[model samples]
Target: MSNNHGRVINFGAGPSALPEPVLEEAAKGLFNFQNTGIGIAEISHRSKEFTSFIANLESLIRKQLDVPPTHEILFTQGGGSNQFSAVVLNMLARWRLLHPEAPAEEAVMDYVVTGSWSKKAMEEAKRLGGGRVNAVADSRQFSQTGKAFDNIPSHDAYKFSRDPALIYYCENETVDGVEFSHEESSPAAFPFQLLGQSTEKQLLPLVADYSSSFMCRPIPRLADHAIVYAGAQKNIGPAGLTVIIARKDCLVDVDAAARLGAAPVPIMLSWKTLSDSKSLYNTPSVLSIYMTGLVLERIDSLGGLKYFEDLNRRKASKVYAAVKEGQDRGVFQKKVKDGSESWMNVVFEVFGEGAEKRFLDGAEKKGMKGLKGHRSVGGIRVSLYNAITEEQVDTLVTYMNDFVAEETKPKAEQ
Candidate 1:
């Protein structure tokens, strides 16, 4: 399964596979970034070369995603887990500034919990204790077993709080293979129209965690969101780089808000701090930013988000088709309901005892790996990120079809 350079087809979820060409270029940049003799890892974050590179990285993202002037892109250290706390702290501060006389108990944070990641985010908000946490929609309640992250609750099921401090949702659930449809007409799509109607003359306090599906496609209603963030490792570069797209209004002075009775936000987690210093308030993830810049450049040359969107759509279609075929043959079972399946991660169960093991072993034998599901939920998961090529997906779908055909054969065929 190894390529000429000894690289195997990697399907790992995070710290996942990157483009081969980018890796090759990055290997050179490690020794001499921008021909400055100084390697990217050892270079100073404040240096002109590094700063310019970071600025260009922001520009690339802006151009590709069509981010408007209302938002600012900032990069930092923490992964999405850290943002769980940051979002609650910062958004609550904004709420406090708007309602100086209101008690913290009076403010509510509405969370739409669809899967593992969104549930974790809601839990973090509760733990932070800045405001009351409410689940606008919990997918578990609508699931078959009465408790499972296996579906996207219909739009009608969501119960949004009027003028909540923040309305949160994860764009894609990598672990549970559940995602809201980008199509507004779909029942599984996020109920955007229902938001902001109750609060007149104010922008919606909307936030989304696009950690796993960032850069895979154009975000729907990008301008309406107050904050959208993602960790780089999933679809862009490596770990350590977290990108935040914050609406200008959301970047409030946290210390000032604290003086007004809002919870004190740590300097590092404050969006205003990161925005003011241009994402270099403190030392940044130099290596990750450098590599990500390279990836963004590659993406631009290949026609940007439109190119990857079409490619990713096709890749997911192939994989899902294989899964459907297997299900029809009684060799596989889909985990997520129709219209909620994630284009990034496809989770399903293989039929028969030892059959799952056999599938894994066979895939490994063919040089494909990282197909195992998340530990909390056991099944097979195939992650189709931007870096995974159509040829590679074809290879996987071929294996899946072969496995189904073999599984359906009579045991006496031997």
Candidate 2:
């Protein structure tokens, strides 16, 4: 495939690169899906064809992730940002019902603040104005200074409420480039393994925002989560479509919540509305769903998540190797700790004045783009999403090597 989409090597964070074959197939669907003569975008959401298509899309997610039958896959508008509020409102509803006599102000929602995204989610819970949002484990507490969030807190750092409304976290914090341990046996793996240990009762009311990291690898403890939602802009397809895997119990009724002195859940924001209607509660993002469906089909053709897991591990390894080489030359410094490093987003700091600009300029000249870090934490961020092929990563790594060599050479010798 050619670099017609944008730069030769695209490492943008969200609205990131997509597989070429998926793009071509989606382009065809934009004209016509399944040779139906009508474009997928033009089809009615109420029609049997569209219903069946959405059902298949749900099945595809279930198959790939092995989502338990207790969870229901629902599609909705508004990205993961919308779910931040929805989750609080919905889960608070369940909490109120479970403890009818408890004070509304006493209801706590625990959050593990790893990076900007999880922090923002916590802020939104406070903005909702009902329950208390506690920082169960703020990684910033473990940062070198009190400002930066560059590492995952030790398991002992977390203080989840015994009977909280919900516990929230971002699986991969997109902005600060911190991610949970993908290795199951590692001590740095997911911190909530002990939360739902008892098989006698239900799983803890946990919510995860996997907006940027979803589909890149397999999810650990998939069955134990109350809700896991991802915006389609990153690894799957376009924006405007958010895929949600919600447990049936989390889709509580808003009116019932209000009667129990909890905040009213907005109709559109309610997971129950989408789940009850099979995600056709209103006119959905048809084109985005269609494109994502095409992407999932491509994934299945390529041997599902296992193929991507191995490829992503290799890609991240190469990028990290390049970064380590530059670090040894005193030209770069890795942002996150070793085990907490994100496989999907590699972030680091570049040393020397104008060195960052020079690096970006050199990358641009080589047809590599979107390596700039988030505005708040500026340095370099190379997003290795599922669509970013290993070959593209190699091109960037080679350029990185050349950039380091050029920057570190003795000036007087020249």
Candidate 3:
């Protein structure tokens, strides 16, 4: 295996690769951050230096994603999993404030279950029990097996509630490698137009879990959603920090809602508390925030999201092309449907006996790691996050092409 400072071209889903330069810069910050004479990990989150750093991080996201004034960028410790329950509690609180006399059953949380993550989020919402949970459009119903998450359901299949507390969907599913297309005309795209029509004049209470796809490209209709949250571990930094872009109105006073007969919310889970304290209600994930800031700064220097959007599109195209070639040769089978395929995570099965293991082992031997899929859905998953450069993708594609050729060869010739 070729060694570049002992680092492999990582293709893991979360806690994925960071740019080499960012790592080098973070290494220095680990020792001394902003010339504070203390490491970033040791620096106080409440200190002026740390606060300024965090503010700049928020600014980077806002400027790059073009977040409107109506939305506030928030940083917190819990990952996207925490936000699943928190979104339910907080959005229900907002709904309860609006409908003081309404019963819990009247408040519905609409979930578009395209993949595993969204299904889990819906389960979490059901577990919380503050409101009714409805699967507005479940992809599994349309899958070949009637259970696998292999496609984005047609927009016509959606059955949104009249006035849902929150309409939730995961922008990208890392495990199943299903993503909503950004193109409005694509069948795989999120049905924003339908939601707009259903909601009428009121702002859509749309909550998107962008954990795997965050910061990889421009967010589609950034201003339309009430909340867009992601774990930094996927494309930004470490696992501890979750970046939340919440509409100003969605940050309701949970205590007041509870007083009005809504379910009580914990202080830490309250978005209003985080916004009031400027995300310093408690000690923040200092190191994760610091590294994430560095990553954003680097992204800005590299021509921002536009550059990444183009680069990542090219990278994913190359991988998908290679997969298609393998499929044509009967050497591989893609898991997801054509239009529903993820640009970030590509999942496909290796054909023939012991072929999957051979594919993974060969990739590892060539210094490419994290090619294995999730345990729940065993196959090959190539996570092409922002940090995975075009050249690295080229290397993997070349390996894939070579593996396909070798597998399709006649056994008699061997």
Per-residue alpha-carbon lDDT of model 2 for 130-246, expressed as tens digits?
878888889988888988889888888878777778888898988898999878776667775767542223668888999999998899989889999999999998898999999
- Candidate 1 Cα errors over 4 Å, as ranges: none
Residue 109 local lDDT, model 1:
93
If the candidates were sorted by their TM-score against the true structure, best first, what order would they fall in?
1, 3, 2
Model 3, span 1-414: residue lDDT tens: 335578989999878989888888999999999998999989888899999999999999999999999999999988999999899999999999988998878899999999999999999988989878999999999987899999999989999988889999999999999999999999899999888666643889999999999999999998999999999999999899999999999999999999988899999999999999999999999999999999999999999999999999999999999999999999989999989999999999999999999999999989999999999999999999999989899999999999999998899864
Candidate 3, RMSD to the unseen true structure: 1.0
The per-model lDDT (C-alpha) reads: 0.93, 0.88, 0.93
- What is the clash count for each candidate, in the order shown? 0, 0, 0
Point out the higher-scoring one by TM-score: 2 or 3: 3
The pairs that clash in candidate 2 are: none
- Candidate 1 lowest-lDDT run of ten: 193-202
Worst 10 residues of 3 by lDDT: 193-202
TM-score per candidate, in order? 0.99, 0.97, 0.98
